[model samples]
Target: MELYGQVLLIAMPIFLVAVLAEMWYGRWRGKDTYRTMDMISSMSSGVTNVTKDVLGLSISLLTYTWMVDHLAVFDIKATIWTYLIAFFVLDFQGYWVHRIAHQINFFWNKHAIHHSSEDFNLACALRQSISSFVNLFTFFLLPAAVLGVPAQVISIVAPLHLFAQFWYHTQHIDRMGFLEKILVTPSHHRVHHAINPEYLDRNHSQIFIFWDKLFGTFQEELRDVPPVYGITRPSNTWNPVKINFQHLWLLAKDAWRTQNTRDKFRIWFMPTGWRPADVADTYPVEKIDDLYGYVKYESKSSGALKVWSWIQFGITLLFLMYFFGHLGTIKVPGIFLYGGFIFLTVYAYTELMDHNPNALGWEILKNAFGSYLLFSTGDWFGLNHYFPQGLYLIAGYFVLSTLVTAWFVRKGITPDNFVTQATKSQSYSTLNTH
Candidate 1:
């Protein structure tokens, strides 16, 4: 956990720099791929994913260490060849894991957040799953176990393998000449992320492009066909927490609604986006049918609302940095408390971005609870040691943010306002014509 925190301390800034650089580069080329609310939601999704990981909130169905201890066949020595073998084994395992997530209805919920963004940018790369508590991919590591790869070796390489995937999520890089055949380049990954009919489920490789090629899932980026990013069913909201479980909730509802006993039992393992026949007819969910008619999910936000959302995201990020630095000192329960605060902060601000009126009330309640917690605790998990006056600044921030949020809410600061303005203008013009 400490190691993860340390690595994240370095990684978080690098990710920010890369995303910002991509945004700037896109504008330079006269195209803006970064939407403010979409980017915020993407970054918030990353925060939840990392928080879940750093808190060690996962259950293992089978232990890799146990498998390595018992299934040793080769007793391979720890050398460069073993590391290469391990890397290939890991990538192979990753490909299947990625494939199943898209193929199965139940498992797709955990992965849907990654493809939920309409715009493909580096920030969207951070849209990882927070609902992934079960570690059921142990069977994929059997090749490594048979070869007698040590658990220590896996622990070292796993983070590197995951981090290796982050760079390819960008739209900036084009086709690489030689590396195109070897590694998973940006073009290859873009095909994977696209929802266009041709690119729907192609290119499931993580680090290597060969896995997709060998498995018959490879589709090269063609000049004639452009990739349209995002899933068929738009989530229509900016909350990552909600996006994580939206599909699962649909499955649960279908299981309850369907009269057929067998259908209820089998719905989870059915193909992706399948619903019980009766339930599908009675409670029809609208899916995007026409490519030309598709509208990206967006809310009307005044410039003030946009600036307010950024301020909230920036504040939550600073608090996250503080939590990571003091991770060792904060007790387990305190870790959860602090993490919960950060999560709620994300939920509140994101709800505001969605232009949900209820968001103001949620934010006000969250701040009230936060203020009381600090007043009673008198410290932010040992942060008082660094700066005695910091708590005052934090308290003032909570109070002031709540007030600012309330003001925005009272101003009718959603896209709905634009519609209202249009109606009033039309009415005045009609009166003048009469």
Candidate 2:
């Protein structure tokens, strides 16, 4: 838990650095929004999506931990060089996993959630299906187990690799020049996120761009060919479950409707959105042009006010970091605290991302569940023995989380409120033009 907390602590500072980098880039490019609602929407949604991905990865970690423990093949004496070798090998394996995810139908169904965003941002990088656990387990851990790598090493290194990739998801950063030739930067990744025909299935590297170049999957971002972000099909909103499973359901329906077995198999195995020939003929295709282009409602905030909002967000992030740090050291109560914090954070961020004001009810329900867990679970679900103080930390976390949610609710509809208005305005404009 402390390790995870530390990773997040490290990530926050990196995130701030990335934000500053982005701001500088934006200013250099002479880009400033009269309305910052879109920025808020993207940030909020990206965070929610990443949270879901982390939760899914956590489950996979638990399974991997159990397997490693059961097999008893851990190594403590391995040098730093060995760990480095393992990291590259694991990442090399990830490249194929990522590639197959794009190529194979069943895998793509789950992976499609990540591509659903029209906007390429750091948060969107985190949007993946819970079912992706199957791929994570089978592709990465199985090989390590075969090589007699210890479970402890795999467990530690896997998250490290994952956490390292978080900053590469944003559109805020540009090409890293010579480093961009070798390492996967924001620009390199943004190209991968693009739906442009030339961009699709390119740049499949996780930690290093060398794999993509070696495998002939690398496509450098060209100014002449402006990248179009998002999947071929766009998701309606930021509902995590829906985003994750929408393609699965679509494929299942397509398979069921197809009379031929081969067609059914193709529907599940081929690239995403490939239906049976008969269905494709009947279903009109609408290829979206700009994935990041969404209806933006206006914001009334002045420049000073916008700066103030960002400052508030920074403060909130600082508090969250401290809170997570404290919770890491405190056992017994840590379980409830960790779970409740994650649940609330993911839930709130999801609502904020979707631009839906109605998410308040869901947030309330989440808090209610957290309260129930803390009050009812005496053991903090098995962490009690770790700390001499026991569940006091749990009680404090519960109160703090509750207060935070109260404050979030008090802030009202958030930036999404303006987004909804922009959508309405677009609708009205269309009608007037007609």
Go through the candidates in order and give the clash count of each: 1, 8
After superposing candidate 1 on the true structure, give the runs of residues whose Cα lies further than 4 Å from its correct spot.
413-434
Question: For this target, which candidate reaches the highest TM-score against the unseen true structure?
Answer: 1
Residues forming the 10-long window of minimal summed lDDT in candidate 2? 425-434
How many residue pairs of model 2 clash at the backbone? 8
On residues 1-434, what C-alpha lDDT tens digit does candidate 1 reach at each position? Answer: 87889899899999999988888987797666777878989999999888888888897899899899899787777888888888889999999999999999999999999999877888999999998899899879999998899888888788889888989887667789999999999899888887778889999999999998998999998765667778888898889999999999999999999999999989999989999999999999968776434666767667888898888988989989888888999968888888888878888888888877778888987798678768878977887899888889989999898898888778775545532211111221121110
Candidate 1: residue 86 Cα off by (Å): 2.0
lDDT of 1 at 48: 88
User: How do the predictions measure up, each by TM-score?
Assistant: 0.94, 0.67
**Candidate 2 whole-model C-alpha lDDT, 0 to 1:** 0.60
- After superposition on all C-alphas, the RMSD of every candidate to the true structure, in Å, is 6.1, 7.4
Native-referenced Cα lDDT, model 1: 0.84
- Candidate 2 residues 146-241, lDDT tens each? 455665666677777876787787655667889987788988887898777888889999889999989899998876566666677666555555
